[model samples]
Target: MKVIGKHLTVDMYGCSFDSLDNLEFIKTAMLEAVKEANMTLLNLSYHKFEPQGLTALALLAESHMSIHTYPELGYAAVDVFTCGDQSRPDKALAVLKSFLKPEKTKTTNIMRGDFGSQKDMKPRIKISIAPLRRVRNTSARVWSLLRKK
Candidate 1:
């Protein structure tokens, strides 16, 4: 099997209900998770439900990560799909699990970009991650303020 990427699908149960409903916390936690995974954050967007729950998506240079919350059930589903070895999906999952404090976590790892025929050609490249201090602050503020409305 030819593998070009790693994808992690995580199911977190028994998390803090209140935290899942907080958009600001979710965005910050997600950004922190991406940083912890050593992934490059390209962009991030999040939306809050009518009364409760939230969904956040982080676009990364490696790939993408998404966190969908079901506050009423105290559950969240997170996906961390990254190409290349530079990104650490496990580290990202650890950070998210720590923040959510889930009693039970189920994770599945999948190999992506598998080509049946081209097994010999392995393409690789190195990338530099830009500083996110300014972008992070601005995004967090916007998400937070929007949630309050």
Candidate 2:
């Protein structure tokens, strides 16, 4: 598996907060994200057990996009996990960030698979990262590597 991920400091403005309280907005946003990511939407699972929090997950063929909200703190956590065709996650993330607007964000790159100790049977990585080619500091890379492992 080839994976490139970004944790974005999205700009979560009043719009994000408004969306959290409205079911229609959340559904629309999630559906739009699915289409933008070019992923098939299998289903959606929403949880509102906690009045102050809301969790919405969009199940996609590529992977998943999840959002957790903290209405009290006026904050939210978003995750886009795509395995094959790494561009999907970045694209989806970009849309999400643009709409949500997080203040602080960080992305980590992960190369899964290719555990080939021998000359043969090289593992195939499914991700392609041409879309997420951004300059990042070496220290950030090290931190992400350590955390991912």
Candidate 3:
């Protein structure tokens, strides 16, 4: 099996509350990160919650980047996943750190795709679906018909 991508997850702590809660700032920061990381940005979306907090997502050609903020806790969770050898997810993380300025961070790096040889692979789980049942009220019926094979 071949390695295909890198996924970086960062738990940023003690970040600036204002920066995390600011939707516009997060938008700009995400864009800057994408540009600096050399990831191709296909689309960007964000939502600001009532009261506080925000969530932003960037759909990229390589993969995607997302950030969820907790202003009350002065924390933010960020994820950057990119496929291919040329994408630099670490650079994107650095860009976000510079803008958010977290006092402490816990970062994790994961190499995605199958990393073991074929012989070492575990057998996949197989699921079998039971036959559909007729009901008088089909529209409101709930189906519980899956079983492992």
List candidate 3 stretches off by more than 4 Å: 115-149
The order of the candidates by TM-score, greatest first, is: 3, 1, 2
Better of 1 and 2 by lDDT: 1
User: What is the C-alpha local distance difference test score of candidate 2?
Assistant: 0.64
TM-score, candidate number 2? 0.60
Worst window of 10 by summed lDDT in candidate 3:
140-149
Candidate 1 vs candidate 2: which has greater TM-score? Answer: 1
Taking the tens digit of each residue's C-alpha lDDT, what string does model 2 give over 64-100? 7788777666666677766565446667777776666
Model 1 scores worst on lDDT over the 10 consecutive residues at 117-126
lDDT of each: 0.90, 0.64, 0.89
Model 2: worst 10 consecutive residues (lDDT sum): 2-11
TM-score of 3: 0.77
Per-candidate TM equals: 0.76, 0.60, 0.77
lDDT of 1 at 61: 96
